[model samples]
Target: MSAAEFDWNLATVWETIAEELPDAPAQIQGERTFTWADFERRANGVARTLLDGRASRDDRVTQYLRNSPEYLEVSHAAFKIGIPAINSNYRYRDEELRYLWEDADVTAVVFHGSFTATVGALRDRVPRVRQWIHVDDGTQPCPEWAIPYEQAAAASAERVRAPWGRGGDDLFLLYTGGTTGMPKGVMWRAADMLRQVNDVSTVHYALEDGAEGIRRDLRGPGQAHISGSPYMHGTGYFGATMAMHGGGCVVSLTAPGFDAAELLDSIDRYRVASLAISGEVFAKRIVDALAAEPGRWDSSTIRNVLTSGGMLGEQSKRALLEHWPAAAILDGFSSSEGFGMGWSLATKDSIPETGRFAPGPNVWVLDEHEQPVEPGSGVIGKLVVRNRLPMGYYKDPDKTARTFREINGVRTSVPGDHGIIHPDGTIQLMGRDSLCITSGGEKIFTEEVEGVILDHEAVTDVLVVGVPDPQWGQSVAAVVSVEPGAAPTAAELIGHVKARLAGYKAPKHVVFVESVPRSPNGKADYPAARALAEAQRQPVA
Candidate 1:
């Protein structure tokens, strides 16, 4: 089918899946399992509930639940009713939650009972929220103002018809970190989101022929999958959606926090075929767990290990290879924005520096002038996108126009990234352009230094930043996690980077820490890293 001819709507996608695989397992959370038919019924009930409550088309409903079957039901139900569902990052404190709730104009919030205190603290701060619903797993008490999730589901009507809207209707409002100001919401149309499913089905999964071929070859009955990232992020959303698209079972582990052992246990119990993990931290944790109990879990069912959002540094990559050599480790670069860009299918010979893949259609690496850079130039440029780009940031047109621009008649979206386009058209991603620093008249990218440090045997994970220096405008600083019981000095890390990279790019100082903070999507928390560096530079009284 032609791209234009394809119907890019969530309802259409869900209908197709329901027709093709009515009895297939759509979602699995702990011991709970939902077939495709069951999912549709639950989603319909949710839509009826929201509609009866006077929810209008395109109204925003924020979800603050952990990984569970309820989150998926609410998401699908919101889509069926033509209301956009915003996934709130669980890490947000009261202040951050209040800001997002106020900014998104969230009319309703669905949160787990455990977060009652946090939500209660911000009740007066968020004036837009009209309804408060709590998902109680039987332990926590339902608050006075909140409705129980099960009761709401049972009371709401079922099999409601779709709300009137076209494919371009708003589907979601995902908030991304801002370069200069507060986090900005990127609005996604239903058609644009359907394009994401198309990209996954057509480009990534190579499922152009349709569901028959996927069912015959790629997936079987009760195919198990797991996403080790928070549902609020893009990767988790993509992974869950793709699993449903293929008629596979999505296994969600509702751990109090990230625990590699618990994740592996779920995989072993479910015989999960696919696993999506964000960064090297989770990967390394899995590797360590496997090492500690080599015979405890049966990981033979795992076939694909999808990693993204941040670097799986050379160390973690090597560890994964050693543990799960047969699994295909696929890495891709994408954003909350509609740009689904590059991919790298890990092979036996793939390395951190070599075998990086090229971006797909609608993506390009451009120079400072926003023109496509010449191949083999080795000059770093901003990464740009050309297809189905966001119209503008929510409520901020001027800044949106600045980032999403038209260069030489073709529109492009540059999400503040530094990269190099190789002669073969492959792009090597450097850190964000906003994080680049100039020290002693020399410009250096933090990612380059972090990559070098990560290659060291003793380092588990690392982050690079710029700190205040007396002479140099800014000095390179490194924060790293070392192997348990191993300590390396700042001079050693500097020497390691100096040997592989230019002398000026070497870190001037290094600090060892238990772990580096990361965004919900596994991107390096550079802001936190820079704050740590700044705090360290304080003058002694």
Candidate 2:
């Protein structure tokens, strides 16, 4: 590709790679493998389906399914047809699901059969959703109104031509549940997002001057990558897209949820070159699995282990190096809003601190007064991107104003994290401030968890707090004031939470009391709650 004909959009770039390397392996999900040819054809089939709907440019399509080839295909399909795709958290219950779909103004949904009841229930609520594309995973029968994924995909294998082509101005929405209440969509334009997060994320690719240069750089023995995290999230989606952008193969986990044994089996079978994961949650589990039965699976093909989207502590990093001695472990710092804030590389020779990263040219730290914080000041401040960043929160003017602020006339995305800038120009992260706890790299908003726990029949009042743990950076502890004579055991209450919110967000420990401590004005005294929970963890002495 020459300068006059260069195209940088994801769909175009991917089609070019397929044209150049048609026989190469592109996608792997459990027993299924898609060659570049197969992937391109299926993606085109999806594009043709959307074209039949006459989907105008910039329309929104939401994916309400777990990680699968269909998920990626729909994203690729939407990209080619000049529409944006949104990722919905599969763990969300009925009302939460309704909020996201309605708020996004979703035009279509490509959902799983398991969610038939959920989406079927929301059909009358969201007026904009005109099409329902259903993929049958056998959890339930497809809703009668939905177009079967098989039939919609019966179009020709060749790519379709459209009057409106995908361009750098096109959108990619990454919806994040910021520490507090509902999820917010961070909008990133295609061209900038590619170069910023997707291009530099892969280990196999080096710095290239332009999009064409990167394309030429990709024409080698492309790396094969697998992510232990769910593909819907950044740790999985962005990492896999990085590999895919470099003409590499992306092997996905086929299990319904995070299964250590299944991920290990897939890695060994595919000879995955790069493995991506989150913080302590995944790290401890993987290390323990390897330790339980040494030499049970081959991890020799893995050369790079990347951790991001959460803090991967030094203890977990050390354990990983002990098992995979030959791999390079890297800890990256950034949020769903933007990238290039900070990074740390850990090998056998060097191990980085738990929440520290080497800050570079593009990222900056700012004090409460919106001024740049000098290194070694010991002052905690919000992490902001000084250079290229996202446009703003989608359709959220008020939040956009709050987060993406103008500092000295330049716009930056403040990801709502308070941290320290060390004398050596390293960043020491203290995590987000929304009463949100990060266990194993997944953000657990306290308010949402408390809302679910309060709905239980036996409970009276609850305050969810984070406590220190060797595994999982912090475990959720619920301090509850139960009704008189109500015998709700810890296990039973935990089970109740799992049924409501995602299982990981459930409190690991539940402490019952006659009354929960609260301030006079009815505000939660988090410090008091933390102390009470910490006291509960101590052995009788």
Candidate 3:
């Protein structure tokens, strides 16, 4: 195929793979497996269903489900028919769900049966959603208003190539877990996303060689890559995408939450070649399970243990290597807006200290003046990716301007992360500058939690901060002051926050004080609050 005959859209690439490797397994969940041909046919059926539901090109389709084969199938169908698939955090409450769908202008939603009640309650509120596709998980039957996913997947077996055709400009909107206040959708074009992954990630496609390149690389059934992370997040979705791009099977855990023992068993059962996990949160559990039950699972098939979203400290890496000695632990330093910023590879032979990373080819540490920071100068600067960046935050041009900038004549994505470049060209990652607390790979904004805590009648004032934790990189801590006569226990306040927001955003450590530290003008003294929380934080029992 010539350059004119092919576009850089992922749909085309995926279709090419399907045509080339029809017998290869594409998706696996426990006892269920779908080959490339099966995958293609199901996606085509779903695509026809979406079209029948009047989903237009570039229309937003939301996936409000957990990790399952149906999630990827719906997403593939959307991509095939030129619809942008949007991710919805299943942990979200009613308000969050409403805000995301309304903000995204979602036209269609493919959700699991478990979320039937939530979706039913808010269905009328999100009037823009014209189509509701439901996947049965034995929790509930298909609602009258929603189309059953399996029925939709069997609508037609023929392939679906949209009339608008595929283009590089087709989008995939990834909503960032609200760092400031409300979640914002980051718009990623198909070409940029494909280019970054193909060049930097495990999947390699020679653009000049077109479909032939994909055929050449995917000679047989590719490696089995499994991830316990939710497909709603970037890490898990990208890991699965990379595997599919290489003609491999995307294996997902059926458990609703992360299960270390189950993951181990699945890896051994499927002969999984690569495992994707979040940092210390998952590593600690996996390491402990293996330590407790020695020689219980055959983990020799694992060659790569890929992780991102949080700090996988030196301790966890070393502990993990003890079990999978031959496995290479690839710690990816990335974000939703900018991928391949920096990465660190650790093996039994070589393990670098925590926070030290080799920057990507297009990554640069820019100073306050928007110039490159001098290496070995010990100056911390914002980490920037100069190429293959997302379009910007959808419908939020202000944030788009703030994050994605044209610096020194090149478009760069500055996602508020700070780091220092060493003389050896390695980066010392210093975390984000936005005061966002990343506990167990979840970004929790202090203000969001503080607002919820203050809603309690007994609470007079509250200041939330992040304190160091051995397990999570940083744990959310709340310093609160009760009313003059009211006495609310820490558990009460923590529960209050959990009821309002996701459990991960709730404060892990709650300290009651006489007053919250603030300036004369009532501005929060963040440093002082952090200090107080750190001083009073109790040891995890």
Candidate 4:
């Protein structure tokens, strides 16, 4: 099938899936399972309600629901109306939410009733928000200004098709995790985003027979996915969207929090074939649970175990391979602002020492002067990307231009990550450029340091940060979580890392801690870590 022949609009894709497999499960959350037909009907109903309330085609609707049937319905509803929906991370505080609400000019909001007080605090801050619809999961009282989600959606006419232009319409505005000052909104066009799935199936999956291959292998009867990440992040959102587009089911684990037992049970019960998770934490937990109760659950249905949003350590990778010998453990690297840059495909041979990620079209590592570096040069540079990238940060042109540059007179979006292009053409991600530390005029990436320290026997988790120094501009510091009851000295841990890396790259000071703070998406909370290091330092007399 040619690119022109494929319907790039998300609504059109949903419609096609509905036509092909109307009775197949589109989403399974707790006791509620929504089929393709049901998904379409509910979305259409929600669209009718939004339109009747005078929402414009390009208006923004914000969704604050958890991982449930309503989140999927509202996402589709906004798509049907040509309105860009913003999926709010449930962990956002009032200050963060206010910035996002105002930044996106959100016209309406659909949130869980439990967060009514949180939303109420920001009512006056977001002047443009016209409607507040609440979904109650029996946790808290509904706010006074909020209307029931079901009632509002049911009050409108049924499934009246709206004729909104499809191709170039901005479908969603996802907020970036603000490791910096404030989170920025990424504007995603429908056609450009959906085209990414084509690459996933054809290039990454390497479907031999093109469309036929997709039909037989990816979307065949009983094909399903289980997502452990929240829908607000790119990993979960893309996983669910891809499953629906492929005419497959999305099995939602009903666990309130991340529980290895619940995840394993959900996969076995639903017979999920494809599973996507944030990182090695969930995989390690699953491995530990399985070890405790050997062969208690039937996991033969799982084929692909996709890991993204964070790194999968060697220990967890080995554990996964040991437990699920038949499953292919795939590691993907990308961010909410960027498309999928690389992925490690399933292989029959032994796992290589280096993680393999297939590079996306027009993605490469560039030196300080923005020139592409040769593989195996032992030089690390910023990772730059082109082709179907986001427009820029919403309402922040200064930052948008600084990070997303026009290299060689061609517009490109670089998410400020540093990496080295291996000799074999695979990209080795070296963490974000903003997190890079400069000490004694030498640039050292924090992820490289953290990776080396994590290999130590006493270390459970580690975060490397740059601290202020009198001589050097910044000094390397390590914040670590050691094995319980094993209080390894700071000097001992530093020596371990120094043995693997240059003395300058090694941490000058090490602080043992219970845990390293992480973002919702599993990336290191560098800002918090830096603050902790700064506070712990003794003042110069």
Q: What is the C-alpha lDDT profile of model 4 across 307-375, one tens digit per residue? A: 887666666676677777788877887776678777776544556433346677768788988888988
Task: For candidate 2, write residues 265-298 as lDDT tens digits.
Answer: 8878888889888664576568768988899999
> Which residue pairs clash in candidate 3?
none
Clashes of each: 0, 0, 0, 0
Task: Estimate the TM-score for candidate 1.
Answer: 0.92
lDDT computed for candidate 4 = 0.74
Superposing every Cα of model 1 onto the true structure, what RMSD results? 3.2
Candidate 4, run of 10 with poorest lDDT: 201-210
lDDT of 3: 0.81
Query: For candidate 2, which ten residues in a row score worst on lDDT?
Result: 203-212
| Model 3: per-residue Cα lDDT over 1-541, one tens digit each | 6543446577777889889889888998878999988888899988888886465675788999899988888888888877688999887899999999999989889999999999999999998898999999889999999999988899998888777776777887888773346788999887777776677557677765777777777657788989777778777888888888788898878888888899999889889888778665577678778988998999888898888865566767887888889899998988888888888999998988666799999898988897889999977688899867888999999989999999899999988888778899999776566787889987665544664665576765677889988899999999887756898877777778778567888888888888777532133567888999999886323
Off by over 4 Å in 3: 1-6, 436-541
Residue pairs with backbone overlap in model 4? none
- As a whole number from 0 to 100, the lDDT of residue 188 in candidate 4 is 72
TM-scores, one per candidate: 0.92, 0.79, 0.82, 0.91
**Each candidate: RMSD to true structure?**
3.2, 10.0, 10.2, 3.5
Error of 1 at 326 (Å): 1.8
